[model samples]
Target: MPTFTINGISATVPDGTTILAAAIRIGVEIPHYCYHPKLSIAGNCRMCLVEVEKFPKLQIACNTVVTEGMVVRTDTEKIRKAVTGVLELMLIHHPVDCPICDQAGECGLQNYYMKYGLHKSRYDLEDKVRKKKVQDIGGMIVLDAERCILCSRCIRFLREVSKTCEMEFFQRGDHSEISIFPGRKLDNYYTGNLADICPVGALTNKDFRFKCRVWFLSSFDSVCTGCANGCNVLADFKGDILYRLKPRRNDAVNQTWMCDFGRLEYRKANEARLLVPVLRENGKAAAAAWEGVLSTTALRLRDIADNEGPDAVAVIASPRSSNEELFLAKKLAAEVLKTENIGFTSRTPGDRTSDDFLIKGDKNPNSTGAQLLGITEEGFGRVVKAISDRKIRALLVFGSELSDFPDSQVEALLSNVPFVAQVGTNEGVVSRVANAVLPSASFAERGGTFTNFTGRVQRFSQGFPPRGKAMNEIEILAGLANRMGADWKFDGEASVFRALAASSAPFAGMSYESLGSEGQVVAEGRK
Candidate 1:
């Protein structure tokens, strides 16, 4: 342990901790660039210079390690002058494209310039070095060499984090710029992270560019549903439109980076959305009132349950659904509907699309949550068999698409089933075949928890209102349960989770508040 005084605030930190990190621990701000905690330290950016007692020259805080009884002043005149000089050199040849740059509001260069180097530009605008602007770098990133400060964050990220080594500094001196090797491109699964880690507007996400300004958008913590990894993310949206999904720092899961697949998955929330309740009659689906749709669906299931027993009704939940939704689905089947067959549709059974990183073989985000609630993949085959045998006359599907099941088998099963009720977010093949299509909210439009592959129950909040008449799965289920004479009074997601935690063994001692932004990992045996 080593004791250090950063801006007169004394604290003891472990050996080898940099002055920049130590300063951060005690609420002292040390302005820096190219000092990503996850990436290897490159002392190229001298913006973090600080005045160290007894040291002749101000040292870069990022590379300077704290020693016992060390005194550091981060806001001294010497430190300010050094930081101003560094920032002046950084912006010497940089373009004044702040008005057009996508990263204007969040750009590090702009921030530092206003804070440190507020001096008028000594060099003429035409005299500024111009390289490339809006150059199409591979993998959803655009590059502007003129905007780069050459802090090497992107270079180090590629070399260390992604291990791609696609990016490197080319040329020398003021002409030095980031570029990909000849015939190579920045095409990695984690390439979108480069834009995220880049300090300046030099590198920008191609998908997010010109879409919306960062400051105008509202962000809320949510987990990515692209896979079982359950990468924590910030859902950035404006009004009802989700603009992007940025990786939120979750060391145990995604470690400050998310794959491009998951980053772009937010687009699905806006595409092919099922907004209203639809009833299929004579192979045609027409928009119907929510009350009529739910009542008809409930009556059909009740008839099948009363005539052929509860086993005649099969419930197929989605692995992509939240733990609260899956728990309620299980409760509806076991208690209210009184059915033995209750399971979720496995999206990627025996999937091989996994990597050494965040991407998982199981495409479903809440598969572990479903399993925790006693729903398994084995029920998929059993329910399909029951449908084929004509034993299951009624099928209640939650968020499962026809593509989730074998195409031929699902088609055959749907044809045989007397009544099929589907509750989902999007308009898919299953909704077309379903007698009653009830629109349920997408992950972005609802609040619930998703248990990752390792049993971490992470909570996500509603980023926006449900599209059209689409309600959340909990609301849809609660409405259906009430229609069936069940006294289920779930006011919100919290209440439903409370009931789930009280009744379920795996979810015991867990609540929405306990499963905060980073999430809580359930005990191994409890799950």
Candidate 2:
């Protein structure tokens, strides 16, 4: 460790640790726009200038490596003057559009200006150089050159982190602006990241352009359900409406970034939502209450299991469901329904593409969680075959559309069953063909844990109450099990997870508090 004193506070950091990273370790804030720890240092922004002993001048904290016995002072008057001058230059041609900017509340330039540069403009605002205005860039990003400070965070992120060299600076000096390469668009799987790393309002997401102000949105820690990687994210929503999903740093998993596909999966929670439970009445759908839906579903499931045997009633679980929900589903199948004919979601639609990076071909977020609970995808085919043969007379599907099977084929196969109950977040082919549809809360509205592809269990909090009449999947499953004469009293996700941890050997000694924010990797090999 290299011992150093930053602003008179001592910190001992590892070898080759930069001054900024050392400052972070000691909880000292060294403000900079282009100094993202995950990316290569560009050293273009002088916002992190700090006075160091025995140095002729202030050093940029991002590039300056700490050494043994090194002494650094960041709050000196000399450093303040230097940083104020740098901020003045950065704002010379930058537009004062903070009133309408989406990044206003959380923008680096705006925050830094209030702190350091409150100086009046030397020249007329009208005389400042104007670059391109709101120009539509592909991959769901809208670029506003006038708001750019040329810190190169987005440029560096594209070249270094994403490794997609599609964006570059064009023209000279005041005219220099970020643009995509000719005849090519910024069409990568991780384009949303550019907007996330943009220090200013230059790069903005089109989906979240003017939808809601940052201050008005309530954010909760959540995991991305778009893929098996289970990237951590902040679910921003308000009044039953999910606004957006922003990547939350988890170095063990997504590492400060996530794919654009996962970023846009917030739409599943916001759009085409199933708000109420439904029961088919003579081939037509009718709105149903929780009591009717659960009672009818329980009675039918029991009748099928008793009349046609336990093998005739099948339950299709989903990786999209939480570990608690899956555990209850299995318990419902084995204890209440007394059936071993259980299947799980194998593949999801549009989950076929992948890269060596974060993208996983298996889009289900909790497949590994399902696996840890002894639920495998191998039985899904068998269940489908039974459905086709009309041998499985009753079915309960818990999930969204977490399979790649054709909607028509799913409807055709499900049609053979006399009592099909779909318990899911969205209305799809399975819901359409089901005799009873139970509206279950989406992932954002459910406090649950999703074990990623690597068996890392991460917990996500519920952003808000479920939209309309939809209930948490765990609640629905537990209620139905209780109705079937199985005692299930779960306080919340934690209670069921404790049961899971106790029952599953691989997940032993793990709980929500133990999982924490970064999450814990499961013990290798299962029970």
lDDT of 1 by residue, 1-527 (tens): 99988888889999999999888777788898889989889998888898899999989899999999999888878778888888888888988879999998999888888899899878888888889888887998999988888889998888888888998999998889998888988878888898898898989999999999988999888989899999999999999899999999999998899998898789878999999999999888899999999999988888888888999999998888888899889988988889979876666433447798888888888988998889977887788778788888899988747434565666777888889999998776688789999999888999999999899989988988898999888988988988888999888899989998998888788888877678888876886
CA lDDT of each prediction against the hidden true structure: 0.87, 0.87
- Deviation (Å) of 236 in candidate 2: 1.1
- Rate residue 196 of model 1 by lDDT: 93
Candidate 1 clashing pairs, residues 3+ apart or interchain? none
TM-score of each: 0.97, 0.97
Regions of candidate 2 where Cα sits further than 4 Å from its true position: none
Error of 2 at 204 (Å): 0.9
What is the Cα-based lDDT of residue 527 in candidate 1?
64
